[model samples]
Target: MVEDPLALWKALRNRYNHQRTVILPRARYEWTHLRIQDFKSVAEYNSALFRITSQMKLYGDTITEEDILEKTFSTFHASNVLLQQQYRAQGFTEYNQLISVILVAEQNNELLMKNHQS
Candidate 1:
């Protein structure tokens, strides 16, 4: 008699409401504590950001591009204050734009270091 699984799905969703109690706070904690400098690479930071934000979204949180960009800017390493200011001055409205630029910069820095080692 369960030809339509819609009712079953709804029941599952409602029954699992307690999951939000567990997941939402954990997601928020991870999000707040996330710092780009903690990761070894831009890609790793990006991956973790998406994962945390997606979890927050699942729990009815709105994670906007501006929020993401601001979070990234604010969490940069303290030693890179000038670099952070420069990136912030770029006025990146989208997270992807800023991240792409940072990724390219990281690659260029690595290349420069390799050249220096030669």
Candidate 2:
């Protein structure tokens, strides 16, 4: 949906910020009761941190906007596929709601980036 690479990069960065600031903390808190040694708990934390690092690296000082956009889009697509599989297997009813939320968040991010560019 994002035709401009630079704009897409900015939008992705904003989306990452929103997730880190809003979603990750709440998820972490809700799952904190689980034992740290549990595979699920460790995997969840690692996955979240991996995503954060990947997003940060994409926008890091040395990376070009074009590279960031390409890499971010590739990663996003892969992640979405994996998420879809997981949702289908474990959270069928919640899958659509989650996807809808993600789409709206991405659209909001794009709008914010466009406003900033203007």
Candidate 3:
């Protein structure tokens, strides 16, 4: 469950900030605008996907990321070749967003575990 949307927003901002620094030649335009234009960012890009997942979850779609990876890996997944190619060309922007969320959650979980262990 999402504990705090504000925290999530901040974490996402930080991730984008780091990416902007590490990947030189960052997009000249603002992310919000770019998000509108290209439908990038977690909220803008994956909101619908997440909503669908949430609905599916209510209906027993409890597939984990591992399951997703396994399925994608197994199918030789070319469901949307053009979209896949575009994502690849853009360096897996959606995947990066997902990674950012996972990293944040993992870090938070580790901290909580450490606190509990103490």
**Best model per TM-score:** 1
| Model 2 regions more than 4 Å off | 35-118
Better of 2 and 3 by lDDT: 2
lDDT digits (tens) for residues 16-81 of candidate 2: 766556654554453333222232332353355344435444444243444422332333345367
Q: In model 3, which runs have C-alpha deviations exceeding 4 angstroms?
A: 1-42, 67-97, 101-118
Error of model 2, residue 35, in angstroms = 5.5
Model 1 CA deviation exceeding 4 Å by range:
1-7
Q: What value of lDDT does candidate 1 attain over all alpha carbons?
A: 0.95
Q: How many angstroms is residue 41 displaced in model 3 relative to the true structure, after the best TM-score fit?
A: 4.5
Find the 10 residues in a row with the least total lDDT in model 2. 33-42
Give Cα distance to truth, residue 105, candidate 3, Å. 19
- Evaluated against the true structure, the overall lDDT of model 2 is 0.48
Q: List the residue pairs that clash in candidate 1.
A: none
Better of 1 and 2 by TM-score: 1
Best by lDDT: 1
